[model samples]
Target: MTMKISIERLGPRRMATLAVATLALFNAGCMVGPDYHRPQVRVPATYSELPGWTQAEPNASAPKGNWWTAFNDPLIDELEPLVVVSNQTVRADYANYQEALAEVRAAHASLFPTIGATGSATRERAGSGSVSSAGTLVNSAAARVVNSGSLEGNVSWAPDLWGQVRRTVEENAATAQSSEATLANATLSEQVALATAIIELRTTDANIDLLEKTVDAYQHYLDVVTEQDRAGTIAPSDVITARSQLNTAKSDLIALGVARAQYAHAIAVLVGKNPEELEVAHSAAMPALPSVPVGVPSTLLERRPDIAAAERKMAAQNAAIGVAVSAYYPEISLSGAAGFTQSPLSGLLKIANYVWSLGGSASETLFDGGLRSADVDAAKAAYDATVANYRGTVLGAFQNVEDDLSGLRILAEQADVLDAAVRDADRGAEIAFNEYQAGTVDYTTVATAQATQLSTRQTALNVQESRLLHAASLFGDLGGGWSTDELHDPRHPAAPAAAAAGSVQGGATSAGSGEEKVQ
Candidate 1:
C-alpha cells in the first residue's frame, strides 16, 4: 500500500498563516541603536551689551505682518514684498527647501512595505526530436508552438530591526527643517540688502543735492571774484581759487550719480527686474530711521534663522550617528510573491495554476577591515563638528544683536553732536566768506571754511545712513519674522496651513512656545 499526500491535505492554509505570523514577529522586533536626543547648549541669561536699552515686553516688539511696514516707508513696503517672491537668490533657496522636503517624504516612504505587480506572455516552440542515453535518436518530428502567460504580485518589507530607516527619516526631517530656515535666512538677507541699498541711494541723493547747492554758491562766488579781479578789487589768484572750488563741488556732485545708479540697479535685480527697466527717482528727502525693538539675548536662538539652521543641522548630524551605529546590526527583509501561470493564456487565472512563495532574508557585514567602526567614528566626528558650529552660530547671533544695538546707540549720540557741528561749520563758512569780501581774511581762509562745512554735512548724512543700515541689519538678525512654528513636515502638506492659522495675530513673539527650544 502506498500513501499519497496533497498540498490541501498538508494544510496550505496553515502554512500561509504561519508565514503571516513570522512576518508579524519580525515587525514586532525592537529596533536597534540609540534613540535620538537633542544636544545641550549653554545660553546666556542676558545680553552683555544691552546697557541703557529697554527689553521689549513679550510680544511687544514682535514684528507684525510685513516687518518693513513698521518703518512706515511706502517704498520699502512695496519692494520688500517682491523679495519674497521675485528675488533670484531667495527663489533658489525656496527651491532647495522644496527639494529637501521631497527628500523627507522619500525617507518616510521607507518605513512601509512596498507592493508590486508583474505580468508577462511568451510564445515558445519545442523540438519533437528525442535521443537515448547512448545518443541514438528515438524519434524526430516537427516542432509545435505554444503560448504561456503569468501574472504575479509581490510584497517586500525591510523591517527597521536596527532603526536605520527611522534614523534616516529623522535625519531627513531635520535636514528639511534646516533648509526651511535657510530659505528664511536668504529671504531676510535679500530684503535687508534691498533696504540698505535704498537707504544708501537716498543718502547719495541727499549728498548730490547738497553738493549741487554748494556748486551753485561756489559759482556765484566765482562770478564775484572774477568781477572784483577785473575791477582790480581782488587778486587774480582769488578768482582762480573760486573757480577751483566751484569745479570741485561740481565734480563731487557728478560722482554721486554712480553710486545712485548702482543702487538703483541692485534694487531692480532684487525686485526681479532688468537693471535698465527699473528706475528710482532722485529724492533729497531721507526717510526717518524707525526704532527697532531688541528682544532678550536668550530669544536670539529662536529669532535668528541662521541660528535655527545651525541647530537643525546639529540635530540632523545627531541622527546620522544613529544611522552609522545601526550598521553594526543585521538588515532583515521579508519578501513574498503570489502568482498564476499556465501554458495557455486562458488558464492563467485558474486556481490549479496558482503559485506562491514566502521568504525572509538577513544580511550583515561580518568584517570590513574596521570600515564600519571607522564610519561610526567619522559620523561621531561630523556630529561633533555640527555641535560646535551650532554653538558658534548662537554666539554669533548674540554678537550680531549686541553689535547692532551698540551701533544704533552710538550713532544716535554721534548724530546729535554732528548736527551741532554742521550748523557751526556752516556759520563759520558764512563768516569766512563775509570777512574775505570785507578784505579782513584771505580767499584761502574762505575756501577752508566752506570745505569744512561740506565735510561736516557729508559726515552727518553718512551717520544717518549708517543708522538706517544698522536698523535693517537688526531686523534681519532678529529672524525677519520667521518662527520655528512655521516649519512644516513635508510628509504632511496640511501641517503648515494649520500651524499658520493657529499662529498669533502678529509674527513670532516669545520663544518659549512652538518647536523644541534649543536652550
Candidate 2:
C-alpha cells in the first residue's frame, strides 16, 4: 500500500496578490547615490560697466517678436523671422533637440514593463523506421504526419530597485533641456549675424554714395583745370593731377561693391536663399543705433541661452552620477509568460493544451575587477568638468556684455570728435576752391583741401558704421532678448514636455531655494 500526497497550485487571484507584494517591496527600496543640487556660482551684484546705465522700463506694448526689431529697420524685421524657419544651422539644432526629447521619452518608458506576443506553426513527417526512446521501432508503412502550433504572450520588467531608471530619465530630461537651449542659441546667433550683415551692407551703400559725390567733384575740378590749361592760365600738369584724383575716387567707389556684394550674399544664406537669388536694394539711410536695455549682471545667466545650455548640461551630468552609482546594486527583473500549444489543430483550444509561467531573476556583478568603481569615478569626473564649463560660460557671458558696452561708449566719443573734424575739413575745402576760382591760389591747394575733406568724411562714415555694428554686437551679447523661460514653453514647439517640466522645477527653485541662483 502506497501513501498519496497532494499539493494545491495558486489561483489567478493569489498570483496577482504575490505580484503586487513583490512590486511594493521593489518600490520601497531606497535609491542609490546623491540627489542633484546645482553647484554654487558667484555673480556680481551690479555690472561694473553699467555705472551710468539705467534699465529701460519694461514695454508691455512692444512687439513681442524678434529682438532685432529694436534696431527699427523694417528690412531686419522682415528678415529676422526667416532665421527660425529657414536657417540651416538653426534647423539642425532644432532636429537635435527633437532627438534629445525622444531619448527622454525612451528613458521614461524603461520605468514600466514591456509586453510582447509570438506565434508559430510547424508540419512534420515521422521517418518510416524511426526508433522510440524505449527501443521500439516504427514500421516503414506506418509513418505518420504531425502538425504543431503554439501561441505565447510575455512580459518583462526591470524595476527601478535602486532608482537607476529614475536617474536615467532625469539625465535625459536635463539633456533635452540643454538641447532646447542650444537651439535657441543657434537661432539667436543666426539672427544677430544677419542683422550685422545688413548693417554693414547699408553702411557700404552710404560709403558708395559718399565716394560717388567725391568722384563727381573731382571730375568738375578736372574740367575746370582743362579749361584753364586751354586758356594757358594753368599748367597741363594741373589737369593731370585733377584727372588722377578723379580716377582714384572712382576706383575707391568700385571697391566698395565687393564688400556690399559679400554682405548681401551672407544675408541670403542666412535667410535660406542662394547668393545670386537675393538682393538688397541700395539705401543711403543708415539705421540709427537703438538704445539697448542692459539689465543687472545677475540676469545674464538666465538671459543668455549658451549659459543656460551649459547649466542644463551640468545638471544632466549630475544625474548621470546617480545612474553610475546604481550599477553597484543588483538588477532585479520580473518576467511572466502565458501560452497555448497542441500537436494537432483540432485540440489547440482545449484547456489541457494551455501553459503559463511567472518568475523573477536577480543579477549582481560579484567580481567585476573594479570596473563598476572605475565607472563611478569617471562619472564624477565628468560631472566636475561640466561644473567647470558652466562656471566658465557664466564668466564669459559677463565679459561679452562688458566688452560691447566699453566699445560702444568709446565709439560714441570718437564720433563726436570726428564730426567736428569733418566740419573743419569741409570749410577748408570750400575756401580753397573759391581761392582757386578767383586765381588767388594754385589748383594744387584746392586738390589737397578736397582730398583732406574726402578722407575726413569717409572716416566719419566709418565711425557711424562702427557704432551700428557695435550696437548689434551688444544686442547679441545681451542675449537677443531671450529669457530662460522660453526654453520650457509648449507653445514653442521645439521644446519637449520633459524639458518643460524640468524648467518648471528650475524656475521654482531659482529665487528662494538657496541653491545657486542662475538669475
Lowest lDDT sum, 10 consecutive residues, model 2, at 510-519
* Candidate 1 positional error at 153, Å: 1.1
For candidate 1, the per-residue lDDT at 351 reads 94
Candidates' RMSD to native = 8.2, 9.0
The digit string of per-residue lDDT tens for model 1 on 1-519 reads 975423344476786676567556655666554555666777766666675434654675686447777666667776777776677787677668767877887887887789999999999877787889999766656557889999999999888776788788888988988988887788789888988888888888899899988998898889888888989988789988999889888888888888888988888888776776666777767867887666667667777889888988988888888888888898888788889999977778989998988777989889899998999999889988998898888878878887988899899999999999999999999999999989999999999999999999999989999998888888888886677766776557675344334322123212132232110
- Candidate 2 displacement at residue 123 in angstroms: 2.9
TM-scores for every predicted model: 0.87, 0.87
Measure candidate 2: CA RMSD.
Answer: 9.0
lDDT digits (tens) for residues 277-301 of candidate 2: 6667888788878887677777788
Residue 264 of model 1 has an lDDT of: 86
Q: Give the Cα error of residue 111 in candidate 2, in Å.
A: 1.5
Error of 2 at 22 (Å): 5.2
- Compute the lDDT for candidate 2: 0.80
